[model samples]
Structures are given as C-alpha cells and as structure tokens.
Target: MNELATKHAALASRFQALAEAVQDWDAPTPVAEWKARDIVGHLTTWLPEMAAGYGIDLPKVTGDDPVQVWREHSANVQALLEDDAVTNRVVQTSAGDQTIAQVLDNFYLADIFMHQWDLAKASGQSVGWNPEVATSIVEGMTPMRDMLAESGQFGTPVVLDESHSPEERLAALIGRDPAWTAG
Candidate 1:
C-alpha cells in the first residue's frame, strides 16, 4: 500500500477496534447525546462521501449502515490511490478541484483525525493519534480553514495548546470542542 493507503488502513483499524469495544461498554461517555453508535455512523457516512468527492463511486447501501458505507468507501479510496487515472487527477468540489494527492494528504487525514476523536468521544475511548500525522494534517488544512470558515464548515477559531495531541489540535482547529460533552 502507498503512504496514504497505509495511513487510511491504520485509522480504519483503530476505529473498528473502538467500535467493537463500545458495543460491550455500558459506561457513559462525554458525548452523551451521540453514543458510540452515532460516532461510527458518522464515519460510515462521511468517509465515503469524502471518497466520492474524489471521483470514485463507492458501493451504495440501501439503508444507513455506516459500517458498510465505510467499507465501501474505503475500497474506493484504496482503488483511487492505486489507479493511475486518479493518482494525479483532481476532483472538483465547492472549494475547487484538488489533486488526489492533496485530498489524501490534506483533507483525508484531517477527516480521519477528527472522526477518530468523534469515535473516542462516543465510545468513551482514548485516542492514540500520532503527533506527526496530526501536525501534517493541520498544516495541510490550515490554509483552507479560512475558506471553510465562511461556509461554516469549520468552527470558530480558538487559542490552542501547542503541546496538545494532534487530534486535540485538529478538533480545536475545526471548532469542535475536543473535550465536547453532550450535557
């Protein structure tokens, strides 16, 4: 697998493990309104949508099974990474057409990091987000935050802790409380 694919697989595995754990856990998590199920559902929903934005049409499921969606989307992402036609190609978006590399390097990483936190919050699990990956994702996404800000895709900016983990910084960068609570 290429670098992007490798990162994606690592992230997926982490999430899958968390999903499994949450299935058995009865303890309350901070994101009370959206338990572990919702976090998985969100990843299942958005990951593919993001992949689809890259010009690959993942398998469409009849209902809202985020797991199935994630699986399908992940396949597409993998395919896109391997395909020559898409490797250097640019997919059009509201932000404009970005290269596949850019999508993988910048957007995909950020999405995974944020969703990892989302999953952690819902599942009441701690994330082991790599500081290097987190830093790279933040650097890649920082330029576009201004554009996303006007569209309200990113949250209000706040002072951040430099020593914070990548997931925490990433969550704060996008305006989500890394320590968000349902209550």
Candidate 2:
C-alpha cells in the first residue's frame, strides 16, 4: 500500500483497538453531543458515501452494534484504498473535486485519527498516536480553523498551553477539548 493508504490503515487499526477496549458505548466523547458509539457511527456513515464518489460500492452494515458496523465499513474502506485505481480516481467533495487519494490523505485520514482520540478519551483508554501525524494535521488545519468553526460541524476552539503535545494542540484546533472526560 502507498503512504496515504498505510497511514489510513494504521488509524483504522487504532480506532478498532479503541472500540474493542470500550466497556460503555454510551460514554460521552470530547466531541459535544457525541458518545463512544456515535464516534463509530460517524465513521461508518460517512465512509461509504465518500467511497461512492470513487465508484466503489461498500456493503451496508446493519444492527445496533457500533463496533461491528465500524469494523465492516472500515474494512471496506481499507480494501478500496488498497486498490490503486480507486485511490487515483477523482471525486467531488463538499470543498471541491479532489482525487480519492487526496481526500483520503487530507480528510478521511485526519477524521479517523482525531476520532481515535475521541473514542479513547471517552472510554478512558490510552492511545500512543504518531506525533508526526498529529503535527502534520495541526499544520494542515490551522489555516482552515475559522471556516471549520463557522460550519457548525465543530465546537468553539479551546485554549491550551503551548507546552501541550501536538495531538492536544490538533484537538484544540479542531474545537475539541483534549482534557474532556465523560464526567
């Protein structure tokens, strides 16, 4: 697999691990109004739509089991990423038209990575994510912070100390409070 695909797969793996570790799907994540199950739901729901733009048909996952749904959908996304043809295809996005590979690299991959942290924080699990990836995401999102905040998809940005890690900074950039807990 290419670098983008590999990174997405790694993020997916981390998400799966967090899903497995969770004892309570009802636990609230740092993302306001989203629970542990909702984190998985968001991924499973959007991935197939994103794949559709590349002419890929992913199987529909049913049932109340969020982990199983995420597993099924994420596996389909991984399979699509493994195909060079699918990755190279151009697709229309809300931002504009972009290659599937670009979308994966800039959007889906980042979403999954952040959501991994959300699930972990919600479930009281620890994740050792790649700092390089977090730093890169922070850099990429810095310029888009206002637009994203205006979209209502994200909450207001939380202030954090400069001494915080890149992952925490990235979380703040996207309007997530890194220190948030279910309590």
Candidate 3:
C-alpha cells in the first residue's frame, strides 16, 4: 500500500475501534443533532454517492450493525485506493477533472479524519490522530471557512489559542468543543 492507502487504513482502524465501542448508538455527539451511530452513518452514506461519480460502486450498508457497516465500507474504500485501474481513472468533479485517487484522498479521507473525534467522544472512548495529518487537514479547511459554514455540513468555528493542540484546534475549527466528553 502507498501513503494514501496507509493513511486510510490507519484512520479506518481508529474509526473501527470507536464504532465497536459504541455502548449506546443514540448518544449525542458534538455535531449538534448527530449520535454515535450517525457518525458512521454519515461516512458510509456520503462515500457511495461520491464514488459513483468515478464509476465506482460502493456498497450501501444498513444500520443494523454500525461496526460491520463501517468495516465493510472501509475495506471497500481501501480496495479502491489499492486498485490501479480504479484509482487512475480521471473523473469530472466540481473541482474539475481529477483522478479517482485524488478525489478519494482529498475528500473522503479528510472527512474521516474530522469525524473520528466525533465517533470516539460519543462512544466514551478517547481518540487522536497524527498531528501532522491533523495540521494538514486544518490548513486545507481554513481557506474554506465561509464555504464550510454555508454548507451547513459544519458548524461555526470557535476561537482557540495558538497554544491549543492541533487536535483541539481541529475540533474547534470544525465547530466541535474539544473538551467534550460522554456523559
């Protein structure tokens, strides 16, 4: 596996751990109206529609088993990243013609990195990510603050001190309270 594949696998592993640790699917998440299960649901739901644009068909998983749904979805996405034919194809996106690999790496992977914290906290499990990766994600998102807020997909960002950890900054920038904990 290459760098993108490796990153995807590592993020997926942490996500899977949180998914399996969900003692209550209905637990509230920092994402306003979402729950522990909705975190996985959000990821699984969006991926297929995005993959379809590249002529890739990802399986639609039911919510009956959120952990299994996440595992299967993650595996399928990883397989696509590993497949030369799939990853190499050029696809027309709003951003223009980008290889399927670029689309997956830039969007899907970033989404996973953001939501992992939500899932972990909601499930009453601690979570973290590579700081460099977290910083990179924050940098990419900073320029799109207006667009992100308008999309309603993200909440209004909170102000944080420079001394805050990158992960905390990430959570704050995404409208999540970094200090949030499960009840």
Candidate closest to the true structure, highest lDDT: 3
C-alpha TM-score for every candidate: 0.70, 0.89, 0.92
The residue pairs in collision within model 2 are none
lDDT of 1 by residue, 1-183 (tens): 677767777776776666655543333444444555555555456655766765566554334555555556566666666665666787776658777767675656556667677666655577777778778767766776766577665566443667877777777777677777433
lDDT of each: 0.63, 0.79, 0.84
User: By lDDT, is 2 or 3 better?
Assistant: 3
Model 2 agreement with the true structure over 109-143: per-residue lDDT tens digits: 87888778888889887767788877877776777
Give the worst 10-residue stretch by lDDT in candidate 2: 153-162
Once fitted onto the true fold, the runs of candidate 1 whose alpha carbons sit more than 4 angstroms away are: 24-35, 46-55, 62-69, 92-97, 139-148, 163-166, 181-183
**Candidate 1 minimal-lDDT segment of 10 residues:** 23-32
- Candidate 3, after superposition: displacement of residue 144 in Å? 1.8
Better of 1 and 2 by lDDT: 2
The CA lDDT at 28 in model 3 is 94
Count: clashes, candidate 3 = 0
lDDT of 3: 0.84
Best by TM-score: 3
